[model samples]
Target: MHNAEIAMIGLGVMGKSLALNLVDHGFQVAGFDLNSDNVARAQQEAATLAAMPGKGRFLAAANLTELLAQLATPRVIALSVPAGAVVDQVTDELLAAGLQPEDIVIDTGNSLWTDTEVRERRYQGKLRFFSTAVSGGEAGARHGPSLMASGDPSAWQYVKPMWHAIAAKVDADGMPVGPFDDGEACAAYLGPAGAGHYVKMVHNGIEYADMQLICEVYHYLSEVLAMPAADIGQVFARWNQGVLNSYLMEISADILQTRDPETDRPFVEVVLDKAGQKGTGLWTAVNSLQEGTPAPTIAQAVFARAMSSQKTQRITAASLFKAQAKSASVPDREAVLDDLHDALYCAKLAVYAQGFDLLKTTSERQGWQLDFAAIAKIWRAGCIIRAIFLQQVTAAYQQNPALENLLFAEHFRTELAERATGWRSAVANAALQGVPMPGIGSALSYFDALRCAVLPANLLQAQRDYFGSHTYSRTDQPEADKFHLTWNATPRVQQAQ
Candidate 1:
């Protein structure tokens, strides 16, 4: 019977789990993959997991023709293939597979938002193309994930029920306390054409900054404080109970506690320091620059990753620098730890501020009506950066939708004020001890520069004008009235000895 409510292509880790998740939510799911083995494996997984209190049908289609044949009319299909060229290939294949103009297609991968925009325009009137950025990785797909959807409103409406059913739920306090009667789904309609993916890109950028902050703390604990990895895990565990609570922080603690089976030492100790990325963070950084937004925290995180890649150069430099430096010193251990925690909190606020600023600029530039509150709400669960802190973000936007920057929110401003002393103390101490704290350090600088009403940029503009005849705006005149001055008044003549 061709009564399958929805179809999913690409039965890889995320795809298969999402298919099963739909099935568990009582939606008849038809799934297909290019590899026959993958199809068989997905079928087996669905069967094993379907035993748990679900009454939906699951169909495994051997090919695209079979998959479409099983789906109901006005078909809804989701693609989970690798982003970039593969997505275009799949869409072309679907068109070739006799998909009607009325049918809908959803791309739920890490495709660049601009690429999504182009795809939407390409498929306009030919087929309804949608982009929904899924977060929370494998575990989220298997259970529930945060869904950010964009493109056609009709497409969003068609998938709304399924999205809500399979998305993570948040409690009244905006914490992920698991699915329950009194909770909200972590999914929303972001806007048209690329808005959803753009938001997801910002999420990944903030993730990079957040991760670097955690690593900096870990570095301080290990190198400066002489704490063992297991003990450092305890510090993270304690922090997770406070305002610094987050899924990433919790997992970081868990990772530090894990013992390497071979040597029976903490797994983190044996792991290499080099970091790898999948481009989204870099996209966010580049987009920030394009938008003329200051996202130094995110940019610094990307630089940190790149710097870590030069292991040999850094090792030699460390030895060379060691000879010129005095031994690192610290105040009371507990006091330093307390200050570091507050500094981390302050830096985290800066990172998220920069990310949201990028989103705000992008929304204005692209004409997408993005709801910051809704974005924050959806991120309260399932997504990698989910935290109790996002509840504060939701509240900030709710209090003032027109809030220009997150740091301008009264609550956050007060929080920063209360923690300013400790934050400064931590930064000063780290700098004095020759410990690198790029994430927090960059955040502090960004915040200070953001709040400064006067800056040295006027001199920069004058220098530009002197060198290249670039116009400079006067402080006493309207900014639109550009002025330029000739720095060298001497008449041009050939120099002679």
Candidate 2:
């Protein structure tokens, strides 16, 4: 126990599971929690693992001082605490408890990337501050999870071996290599300071878009096509075996088929409709705006969640505004489904494109030098957004690291071109039928806008100039040269300083 390799603070579900995972990988762990019961439970699980051959032990520490004493010199401690002030509190407490210089602290919470940056600078002289954004929830923690590590390269040197051992592994083809398969670890050094957390934020943003798009597809199938939950589940199961295969889609299919034991209704139908978010998606949308990057699909997904929360208002509005008249003729169900699958695939491309573009823009602005291909490769498994589609994304980046947008990739470009007609038809049909398809519709709009060379922005600029005197740059003139119009004067336009 005195030779414990690492210490884990906050033995909640994620913390405890991760501690056990390290023990399973034969790393001695010293675990502590504010809740004594949590520490006891983790100790019991660790004891069970230690009983097995080739497993390491877990030392339960009573306090911060004891936790530090159990670890070796230059201790490596991981905090699974809630993000924000609590993290700072723990760090300060550790400092007060005789945590020495050169000791490494890893924050494994869903922290804002900027906060990570602040902490790194705040803790610079006292100790090494590192952050690793962990994804895949509790189960993934107990077995394996995608790890995005950043901050303090020296600290990473000490932490890398353990992180890699416990991280989810993937095959050469970008498919998840399960426990039995031989594959490389999903962990990698993303960049400096807040790079890892920023990547994780963007990952959550894409996840929001992905889930909403799937839900919108489900809504179309259930409401417009008159399909039962189980029937829709079957459709999703079929899709899961194809190009759209993903962890989200696979679970979504399973969820749709589940029954509520109490009322004998579909599990989804029994559950409340209001969605919950923990701010990462909103952060991504906000960051995109600040960076001047267009991420309409991601923004629309966040908006859809917000709209879902207004259940009472929606119910009242539904009563006041009668439903639109049904279409004169019902669409062919199979044809619609085919179109939907294509539409979903195309929209997914847009969603990923936006997420990656945001990452690239932020990386350039922040000097993170993030490896887009590596990010895509790691995401192919052990994450909420894991999908076969990411394999293509990985190849796209590997083929050309400077890929401006995912839509421009040859593989994705061909897919989008081939599926554009069906994608458009599905969206048009959804609109005509009065079905809301915000995620899908916004993605299509984004795609169309990107492809258009000339937009209505010229008039927009003119209007801005007319009202606000904001100067406009002309296509004929150098972009750096600006012009203003005096609409009331005889001369319509004049050069501006």
Candidate 3:
């Protein structure tokens, strides 16, 4: 099985990494790239590489025509490219250029969920399509990507062996449930075309929120606590010891510790502060709003990145700065750390909450039974955002399968109560001193959302009465159909049944 036919399209960072991974794992891989240089180099590299664990050999396709002719009829084609209309165009090209109907085409790009659905139906009865989300960035792309795949169930079963060769392990509960044995825990046929993308969309959304919140904590420690980035890095390193620990926080520590050549200071300062979003965050926010789910943490992070881009407004504001900067009041370092830990933990939970809600809502809309607990476990390792606290989330879901939100989890509530006071104090301290802590603001908003008594805008029924003549009853009045027209300042028109 060292020569299983695999053809990879695109020779960019992700494509190159994955193509090489296939070559390493002993699978006979044929690689193609639009760029002449990259393709040639990849060809040279593939031929030179030795057999790796569970992968195959190497072949290079000079062009589309050559590649198609060289590979077996029912080839496994991997598409690693930019998302949106580009995917459709490329797929169309493949079909137009004599790609076989029995071929297995996998889209490893982070395409939109709706588009994946459309593509699946468009190619129905013609070919098998798998929409998979691959994580771990460029480096992880080669070693292995934590992949979420969804397509025809039978097709997924046929491709299971290849999927395992490319995925990390652990069941959905984050428990060390599966070995690198029977199956790949990190990858699964999430039930249909859009499901994988739906999960990945929410994944990026949570990522945006998590990174922004981390930045806030960084600012508080640096600007307020007068701690060095190196010290902050050390703290994050220590956080890995407990449930609050994660891969993002771990890399954050390394990033903080990395030094700059010119200033002899942390390289974090040298890097541009203006956070750049790649549209996934915005897409996640829009979807949440459309589905009537509250994704405040991720939404705030997108907004925070926007604020970072406004350097000129900030410079202008700083020109008239109040000369008296607040002097530091040294509280118990351990106690303050405890507060940060609690706040970070709670804020992170909110990020996951937003993402899970997105998945859940999407699942309902799509008619799929996606196990929430399973996603948590698979994310525990081999993903960019892997964190120790994922174990807690996994356990939380396991304890109560039917629970609506993570906030209602008993274990989480008990944990929050123990340290929430310090967290609140830390957030308040930043607010009092006029520090623009977007992450902290998001954390506060998350707390408020958890404790929110009533979402007034939840009155979709009243609006229904104003338009389509559907009626809603208050919590106190179960059977009443009268519309609450005074709030909208419009007369309600009741439709005869």
Candidate 4:
């Protein structure tokens, strides 16, 4: 009788890598894919792993029936299929193929959080529907990745050990620990239903903002400062040694220094300027709007990508409207560099603050009760956004779990206070140089708006009340009491009728 502890339904890159990870951790896995070639590749890789000592075997099945037959009773199935309809289709097939009520199905794709909730409801009682948002791309899949799991509490118990075994590890200081290192796994059960996916979505939104902020800095260094690509890469490498150290920063340095094989030019220069995005960032932005939360940096990052996609229009517009010439006098290079560094750090703080605030707001609304500190700790390694910076975030939440915003944290408050001058200087320079810094600029504005006790919304309220009868609340009275007014109250002439 064939016996396997778990079954994997998709054998794409992520699927294959995860299956291999499971086998490496001494868990027997039954794997299946629609494509015969993928199955063969998995089998070959499994053979290689099987040769190694202290590894479990991989069994390739021709069909779902055979796959289920290979698994042990009350089987646990993990799906890495595409986000939308494919997930439902596979779940339906598994039910048809004798998946029992006690069996657990975990969706490990970047599905919309609402969809995850819907699926859990749709498959309730028939089978345990669960989800875990996996991050760190293909390499992390093969080695270790940060996992955010949610759904039925009972299902979590069944999958916890397997997830912890394959998740990346980190030390107390948030430094990534190697496989042999004695460290804690970067995996945790976030909450019920869509909480895990919701956290992952916010992670992606912050990622978008972080990437755009870096690109804006690169643009300033390259276009405004006229620095060479290699020089900028060196600068990025240096920055990666400090607070800005992160997976994206490290990869960006490598990308910059790399040369295209055909043209022998800087790899970045050879690539197209247009950036593509999946739907996660858009979902984050839309959700922020729906929740009445301010996430301008994240929203602007999404818009930046949208603007980049219209490259042809930008090209024509470039010729049509001329920008004012920049001043010929160059500022002190060292001072400017320092300003940019501090500016980036400050903007990054704002981005995280926005992301966390959104998460907190949604968690309360959904009754998820997500542990902010735990979430930050898990993100310390094996995720795209992993950084030492997250250590401070973890500390902030640990000190005060009900923190209104990250910017209000004592540590972050001091950081912003010390860095405000540099942040202002950097934004001013970018504007004067005619370089677009939407991510950083929007972040600065978000910070200022939060700091302000009184804003110009009074006039805005009046305008709204005038046109749409959307009554305005008086500043002197309780906000619950709204009032309206009639402006142009002069008596009408009798002849007008």
Regions of candidate 3 where Cα sits further than 4 Å from its true position: 1-4, 51-55, 170-184, 321-328, 454-476, 484-497
| Minimal lDDT window, size 10, model 3 | 175-184
Model 3 lDDT tens row, 274-365:
87878988999999899988888888888888888998987898887875355556757777788887788777876787788778887887
- Give the range where candidate 2 is weakest over 10 consecutive residues by summed lDDT: 322-331
Estimate TM-scores for all models.
0.96, 0.97, 0.88, 0.97
lDDT of 1 by residue, 60-124 (tens): 88777888899887899999999999999998898888888989999999999999999999998
- Note the Cα lDDT for every prediction shown: 0.90, 0.93, 0.77, 0.93
Preferred candidate (TM-score higher): 3 or 4: 4
Off by over 4 Å in 4: 490-497
Q: What is the Cα-based lDDT of residue 88 in candidate 4?
A: 98
Looking at model 4, how many pairs of residues clash? 0
lDDT of 2 by residue, 1-497 (tens): 46899999999999999999999999999989999999889988888889999898898888999999999978999999999999999999999999877999999999999999999999999999999999999988888898999999999999999988998898877778774367988788999989999999999999999999999999999889889999999999999999999999999999999999999999999889999999999999999999999999999999999999999999998899886735648778899999999999999999999999999999998988899999998888788899998888988999999999989999998999899999999899888888899999999999999999999999999999989999999999999999997789745566797
Candidate 4 local lDDT, 1-497, one digit each (tens)? 46899889899999999999999989999999999998899999999999989899999998999999998877999998999999999999999999988999999999999999999999998999999999989988888899999999999998999999999999867899885477899999999999999999999999999999999999999987898888889999999999899998899888889999999999999899999999899999999999999999999999999999999999998998796547858878888889999999999999999999999999999999999999999899989989889999999999999999999999999999999899999999999888999999999999999999999998999999889888999879999998887757736568964
Better of 1 and 4 by TM-score: 4
